[model samples]
Target: MTLTTVLLLGVAAVLVGFAKTAIGGVGSIAIAIFALVLPTKESTAAILLLLLIGDVVAVWHYRRDADLVMLRRLIPAVLPGLALGALFLAWVDDTTLRRCIGVLLLVLAAMQLLLRWRSPDTTRIGESRPAAIGTGVAAGFATMTANAAGPVMTLYLVAQGVEKRRFLGTAALFFFGVNLCKVPFSLGLGLFDGETLWRTLALAPLVLLGTWIGLHTARRLSQTRFDQAVLAATVVSALALVVR
Candidate 1:
């Protein structure tokens, strides 16, 4: 890697590490950065690997609070969506995928905003099979395409009235499973070669540092503040993706 790319990756790594704990969605910025500096397809694989590391940290921090029942409910729907996404990855054009993600984020954000307005005191809509399936499908497709699953899943979990720690735990575990499953396929696609692995190894420490900062910040905020921060960060990052 060029010095410039290394530097960029380092910076993006820290933000993503922080995002893993603070907002969850900012990892996409790292995805974008890698895609810009490296091959888009290859970067997809590398980012997934880094995200797996982040997922480990997230799960470790939030393990005791996970909502296992809800996790079980969502898995059936999420599995089919992930299969569809993996299929999409086999043929989807990079530009089309990016725009699709940008559009999806905007739509999800608007819907979430409308929902919040409709019930000012409520943080999440009632849990329903249909909603879980819908968001799970969307998240699966988006995550496979652009590593942008955070926002879609965020809306779904937040709507389910998940408490703070449980929400993070569930999200962390969900992504951990998804990304872990993705590893073999990503390698099959020739996205994770020796060079990328070496680079990721070189940058691994940044991931740890960023996660540390993010978790520390995460622990300081109230539940409401944490949720709001996640939402706000999602919206901002979504907009940034569109403009880029």
Candidate 2:
């Protein structure tokens, strides 16, 4: 990798940690960064390791706060979605895959905004079985295809009106489990070569640093502001992917 690519990957690593610990959807920005600096398909795999590291920290910190019921509802649906996404990955070319990721992010962002506008109080949409299944499928596919499940899962959690800490906790555990599930698929697809593993190791420290910063920042933000920041980051990152 060139010096510039290394620098960009470092930045993305920190963003991954911050997103895991603080605002979940902000990691979409890191996804766009990785896609820009690395090969499109390879970028998804490269970032997954960093995200898994961040997940471990986030899960440990918020272990007691996760909503186990919601996780149970979502996991079964996610399996089919993962299978579909794996097939999609095998069929699509790099440019098409990149554009699909951009479109997916934009659609997820729009759905969140529309839901919030329709019910300012934010109904417990996640309680609906169909809603949970849809979110789970979308999340699985997005994560498998682009490492962009952050926004999809965020929208679902926000619709359910989960408070900030529980939101972080639930999201942390969700991604941790889902990401672990993705590893075998990624490996089967030949996404994790020696070079990617080495790069992940080199950038691991920055992820820890970002997690620390995010822990402090999360404590200070109001629930409303936290949700807003996540949505804004998702939109901005989606636009970046589409236009790039």
Which candidate has the top score in TM-score?
2
- The sequence of per-residue lDDT tens digits that candidate 1 reaches over residues 146-224 is 7888888887776766777788888888888877766776767667778878877877789989999988887798988
- CA lDDT for candidate 1: 0.77
TM-score of each: 0.92, 0.97
Residues 25-94, candidate 2: write the lDDT tens digits. 7898999999998888999899999999999999999999999988999999998998999999989987
Clashes of each: 1, 0
Native-referenced Cα lDDT, model 2: 0.90
Q: Where's the lowest-lDDT run of ten residues in candidate 1?
A: 120-129
* Candidate 2 TM-score over all chains jointly: 0.97
